[model samples]
Structure formats: structure tokens, C-alpha cells
Target: MGKNLREPLLKLLIEQKEGYISGEEISQRLICSRTAIWKHINELRSEGYQIEAKPKAGYRLVYRPDRVAPEELIPHLSTTSIGRAVRYQRSVPSTQSLAHEWAKEGAQEGSLYLTEEQTAGRGRMGRIWHSPTHSGIWMSLILRPPIPLNQSPQLTLLTSVAITRALRKQTNLPIQIKWPNDLLIHGKKVCGILTELRGEQDQVHYVVQGIGINVNATESVWPEELRPIATSLAIEGGRTFSRPELIGAICGELETLYDGYLSYGFTPIRILWEEYAGMLGQEVTARTGQGSVKGIAKGLAETGALLLETHTGVQTIFSSDIEW
Candidate 1:
């Protein structure tokens, strides 16, 4: 606690790896007392690290935690700016709400707000997103794009593509995108994205891209109501994953796609999205607030809207809940 000994202490432990580092050695290396070193070790343990302390053998680094804290994620992050500025919380009502507040106060582009638990997580169309404690990823990333407001909606499609690509790279799970912001694996929902922008119709100020991923939750851990429609990476892969690694991979994917979009345009993203779009060319029914339309899901419009080929002709679906 004195002058922030956590990072230095963790550095010492990591340097030792599986080998034991005595308390006196750590104290001497870090210029701190043995008691202070012990305190910092306990702090690391509380953060989910598995450390072993012997009576006379000192401490050994066992394994790192599966957490998304800045300390955990920053070390693994490869993005230039996307996850460079991270605000981590143990619990929050919604990362989206916090990101919106920071965006209003002029938070930098690529700033991230991540939490382990969300009490009131939200999804599209006012649906409640189930976010229990330490079972998934509840995070929001802030961006200030230079494009017009109309192009902002395309960010959702871009994000879905990014996540699907990242998961495929990480887990090789054959991930697919459910148009307009859902990631599915083996036809079960694994991730959801919500993009919110604030600005005039001409110019945009900021965009809060909120993402919720059911990463490591077991089948029994899912709510009874969501068991049929929801599944997690752990449930599908039959193993757990490092949250920090997954978060870092996603940030890197987003940064790459976002930079590409800024330079080339949404055309590139639209092409990638179409490759993983499970609804394309399939007969589906989409219901909006106004009414419902049954049609074959065609390709995306140049503006990123879903082009539905219906009996009434091609209907552009800007927003809807699809059923196939």
C-alpha cells in the first residue's frame, strides 16, 4: 500500500515464475519490508491469482486469475489505443451507462469500461441482459468516429463481425453473426452488442459500444429461462478460458477493423459480416414495432441495412427482431 507496491511485487513474482522467491529476497529487490511484501502478495491473491507460500520456502507463482482488471488485461492487450485506457469495476449497473457518462465528459476514443458483474445489464429493445457475477464479459468501449450519424449504425454490424472473427481465431468454434449484433456458435447465442451514439444527425460526438459475452458460464449456471436460447464458450468447448486473454483479443480485433473502416469504408466490413451472416439467403420473419415482415434475408444495403426480399418487394430493415 505504501507508494503502490502491487505492480513491483507482481513483477518480482512473475520474474521468479514457478521458482520460489523468499520474502527477504522480494523485500530486498523491491526495497520494501517483508511485512509489506506479504501484504502485497495477499492483495494479488485477492485478485484471483493462485500463489503458494511455504513455511520456509517463501512464495511461488502458481497461476494467474481469469479476470479483466486493468492489471490483468493490460499485460495481454495488443491494441494501440482501444484498451489503453481502461476503467475496471467489480460490479456496476451497466458499463454502457458509465461509458455514456465518460463520453459526455470528453473521454478519449478507445477508452474502455469493464466490469465483472452487472446488476442491470441491458440489450436491444429494452431487453434485460442476464449478467451474473464473474461468469461473462460485461464491457463498453467508447469511440468518436469522424463519420456522419447515418454511418454510426454500421458500427453495430462492424462489431458483430469483429467479435465473431475474434472468437473464431481464439476458440475455433465456428462462430457466426446474427445480423444487427448477435454472435452465435452452433446456433446458440454467445454474444450481444449494442451501439449507442449521441450527436446531431450531421455530426457525431461519441459512440458507446457495449458488449456482453457469455464466456465461461456452465450450462447449469445459466438461468432456467435462457437455457434454450443461451450458451457459453465454456459450455460449448468443455473448458474454461482466460478472460483477460479473450478481452485483449477482442480489443485487438476491434482496433484493426475500426481502423480499416475509417480508411477504406464499411464495404470491407460488410463483406466480412456477410461471410458469417447465418441469416443471409434464409427465409425469416422479422418483427418491428410497426409490424412484421416475412421474407428471404438478402444481402446488406450499402448503408448496412438488412435487405429483405418480401412479397411486397425488397424491404429495408433498419431494426427488427428476426425469427427463422
Candidate 2:
């Protein structure tokens, strides 16, 4: 089907889910021909939508897909800026890579890059992220904030809070932010956020916030090696969630927090992040690039750095791997 008619047809079918939408009505609503409407409906079917058609009853949307397509996400999304323009792909090496290219090409803020699978998905410190097709959300968000480079790391913490809030709203589970970015459920990793920036020393460019969530994969679905250290929402909750809905929720939540951060400051988000943090005020060990620091997690400093109180003194850790 032509790209022009795909969204309109889908929207019309959804609006008429309680009943059938005749081909003539769809063609008239979209200002296209009946044949065009028929083709678009067939295309929707091929994309996993259960669109029913009859000679006289027309078409009814019996079921929509769980895939991360714009047709599925954009219509249902409530965000004003974030995710206003989405680039959805069946497979990609990494959403972050594509988002960087888009940023270089001057893509607008809040533009999103989504993929069903990532062949080369990565986490902090170049660690490989396991992303299986049709089982998780592997997406990147583009942001152009007027903040200094030194303070940009706070976005990772803010994103952590956003995702934690979204998950709390959706699943009502006890989700915790592990240090900088990883989301933990019962001590197992369920989501990870990677934030990247491009620009000069003082002035800023765009920041790419890449997020990967283990949504529907079950215990057996994960690799034998990852089974012990990783888990999905389905594995923890004994149920699955709609990926598109979750994606939309996260974008909306991020948009709200990001707007607030731009207008006010990081203090609000910092408070929330500390509240949702897993090891605040607890004894833990953080391994930085320079060395390791073992102490009581004193919480976050004003600059979003980790404040660890060791026997020697209280040291501010800018970057480190947390292990409690």
C-alpha cells in the first residue's frame, strides 16, 4: 500500500472498530478510490492487523499488531513533541547509530528511532545488549536541550526516573534505578539507558537517549547465559504488556520530565531519581575507570555525581559501575 493511505486507513478502521467501515466511506474520508482503500487494508493485514472485510459490511479492525510501527504507536501516543516524528524499522544495527545520523542531518528534537531488533545493540562501556525480535523495545530519542556539557549526564538520571515512573504506572511493580541507568526488578536487569551527545566544548548539539526494555520475553526465551542475570516484564510478572503502549508511555513521561528540566532545573528530577534509586544510603562498591570506591551510598550531589562516604572521606564519583 502507498504510505499516504496507510495511516488514514488504519485510523478510520480503528474509529469504526465497534462496527464495519465501508470501503466507500473510507475512500471518501481519505479522498481516495475504493481500490486504494482495499489495497491499504490488505497491507495492514500483512503487517499483522486483523482487519476483517466483507462485501457489504466493509472493513473492521478486529485486532491491531503489537509491533513497533508508527501506524501502531503514533496514533495512540499522547506526547506533544517527543515522538512527533518516528522512524520505525523492522531491524537495524542500533537505534542510537541511526539517531546520530539523523541528528547530524538536523533532525528535530523529539524525533524517535525505533527498531524491532538490533544486531549490534550496545550499553554503557560498550557492553552488548541482547535484543531479540518482537520481544522488546529498542528505541532512541533525540533531544536538543540548552544545557552545559558537564551537566548533560543528568539526562541519564532523569531518563531513569522517567522510565521508572512509566513502568510503575503500567505494571505497578517495584522498579528501581541501579546507579546511573540500569533498571532493576528484584535485582535482575530489565532495562538499560544509554545517553550520547554530539557537539563542541561549550555549546551543545543533540543528545541521543537510547532505551532497551525486556518486555515480553519469558525465562526460556532468554539465552542460557543471560537467564541468570537478566529478566523481562513477563518473566517477573507472569504476564506480558503492549510494547507500543509502553513505548508511548515512556515517551510521554520523558517529555514531561524533560520539559520541566529545561524550564526549572534538575532538582525535581534528581529528587525522584534518588527516591527510586536502588542503593541510596546503603553500602555498595562502585568501580570507576580510575579505581573502585566502597562506601555508603550517600546519594547524589548537586552536579548529579554519586556521593559515596568511605571510611577515609566522602568522594564524588562522576562515573562508575555500581555493585552492592
- Give a tens-digit lDDT track for model 1, residues 1-324: 573677677767778968998998888878888888877778788878989999888999899866778777766789889999888889999999999999888899999999999999999988999898889999999999999998888999988888888888888788888878889888899999988989898888899999999999877876798999999988888888888889889999999999999999999999998999988999988898899999999989989999999998999999889887
* RMSD in angstroms between candidate 1 and the native structure over all alpha carbons: 2.2
Query: Roughly what TM-score does model 2 have, to 2 decimal places?
Result: 0.97
Clash totals in order: 0, 0
TM-score of each: 0.92, 0.97
Best by lDDT: 2
* Local distance difference test scores for all models: 0.88, 0.90
C-alpha-based local distance difference test score of model 2: 0.90
C-alpha lDDT (0 to 100) for residue 260 of candidate 1: 99
lDDT per residue for candidate 2 within 1-324, as digits (tens), equals 379688777878878757998888887778988887777778788888998778888888898777888877877689999998999899999999999999999999999999999999999999999899999999999999988788888999999999999999999889999988899999999999999998777857889999999999987766799988898888888898999899989999999999999998999988999899989888999998888889999889878999999999999999999998
